[model samples]
Target: MLIYNMWPMWVIVVAVFLYLSIKSYKERNAKDVIILMTVVIIFSFLTVRSVNWLYGWNIF
Candidate 1:
């Protein structure tokens, strides 16, 4: 049931990605941070797309 709705888990994953991005920005190189952010953005986009496909929703 509710477990099938995984948007909440995605939220947590996004939060962790944001935290790592910020940490990398402060302590790591620019290219690494950019790559991390790009990966996270694509991951989020795919997640939303998959959810839309699953529920036939046009929310995005």
Candidate 2:
């Protein structure tokens, strides 16, 4: 239910990631690109887990 309710956030996150990724890659910096991906993955994981915990559900 929370996931459904927060669809906008998911979309925003994806969009930001794509935009940043492209821009970062254009600079040809391997380290920056890798760090960006790692941060996004960790951020998404924490967001879903935190939402689930706060709402007291197992939808995630």
Candidate 3:
């Protein structure tokens, strides 16, 4: 599966967002959650681009 090789990166991205969202929830920080999500989105985009480049997927 194409996803098999890319699972690790996706897992790490999801894990980071999960951790931040939980922490923000516990602390009741709306701004932090928003910022965290924005950062995570950018990180995910970069990761996908890097993965595409690495694997010559041409998806981007």
Candidate 4:
């Protein structure tokens, strides 16, 4: 149930990030792609952390 809450947001974020990454790649916007990927990685990691906390899983 907790994962249910986190998963949707994660999916949306990843989807949008992927879309942007592809778009940037096609446009040859290296800087944009790099920034977008960085943001995606950071957000994904935070999402994982939040999920672990919610599920009482210590991932240290």
Name the regions of candidate 4 deviating beyond 4 angstroms: 1-7
Ranked by TM-score from best down, the candidates are 4, 1, 3, 2
After superposition on all CA atoms, what RMSD does each candidate show versus the true structure? 3.4, 4.7, 5.3, 3.4
For every model shown, the clashing-pair count is: 0, 0, 0, 0
Over the full model, what C-alpha lDDT does candidate 4 score relative to the true structure? Answer: 0.81
Per-residue lDDT tens digits of candidate 3, residues 1-60?
Answer: 455467467759867896897799789999888888887777677767767766788878
Candidate 2: residue 4 lDDT (0-100): 47
lDDT of 1: 0.78
**Whose lDDT is greatest here?**
4
Itemize residue pairs with steric clashes in candidate 2: none
When summed lDDT is taken over every stretch of 10 residues in candidate 3, the lowest stretch is 1-10
- In model 1, pairs of residues that clash are none
Model 1 per-residue lDDT tens digits across residues 1-60 = 454477667767777887889899999678878987987897688678768867899978
Which stretches of model 2 miss by more than 4 angstroms? 1-18
Q: For candidate 4, lDDT tens digit of each residue in 1-60?
A: 565467558868977997999899999999999999988887787777777777788884
Q: What are the lDDT scores of the predictions, listed in order? A: 0.78, 0.72, 0.76, 0.81
TM-score of each: 0.66, 0.56, 0.63, 0.71
lDDT of 2 by residue, 1-60 (tens): 455456458657856886787789999988888877876786677667766776677977
Residue 15, model 3: Cα distance from true site in angstroms: 2.9
